[model samples]
Target: MTKTVRIALQGLTCDGCVSSLTTAFMTNPAVESVTVTREPSQATVTYNSAETTPEALCSLVDDAGFEGTVSES
Candidate 1:
């Protein structure tokens, strides 16, 4: 099933950060879409739940050098 993951991001300094993250998330085959906002420091990722988990998405953000938490939309 497809699920949307609302992520609260921290330490997003610039547009570069957003772009970088967008690219990183897009690389995941299971991810259907991603929307990131800098002012609010949050991201919405739509993906196939059967292929990926919320924790994995959060870890992806963390591994990219940003802090993130997953929440329900």
Candidate 2:
């Protein structure tokens, strides 16, 4: 089964930052889709729990150059 993760991001200054995270998350095998909004500083991430976890998802965001934290919604 798949699981959805919602993340609140910090330090997203521009579209380029959102795009970078979008690219990184989309390339992940476990992630089915992603939506990031810079104005609200949030991202809705859908992924397979079997292949990944919230921690890993946040790591991708961190690697992409933004601060990320997960929350339930």
TM-score of each: 0.94, 0.93
Worst 10 residues of 1 by lDDT: 64-73
Off by over 4 Å in 2: none
How much does candidate 1 score in TM-score?
0.94
* Per-model CA lDDT versus the true structure: 0.92, 0.90
- Report the error of model 1 at residue 47, Å: 0.3
lDDT of 2 by residue, 1-73 (tens): 7988899999889888888889989989999999999878989999999999999999988888788999768
* Tens digit of per-residue lDDT, candidate 1, span 1-73: 9989899999899999999999988988999999998988999999999999989999999999999998667
Please list the residue runs of candidate 1 whose C-alpha ends up more than 4 Å from where it truly belongs after superposition: none
Q: What clash pairs does model 1 have?
A: none
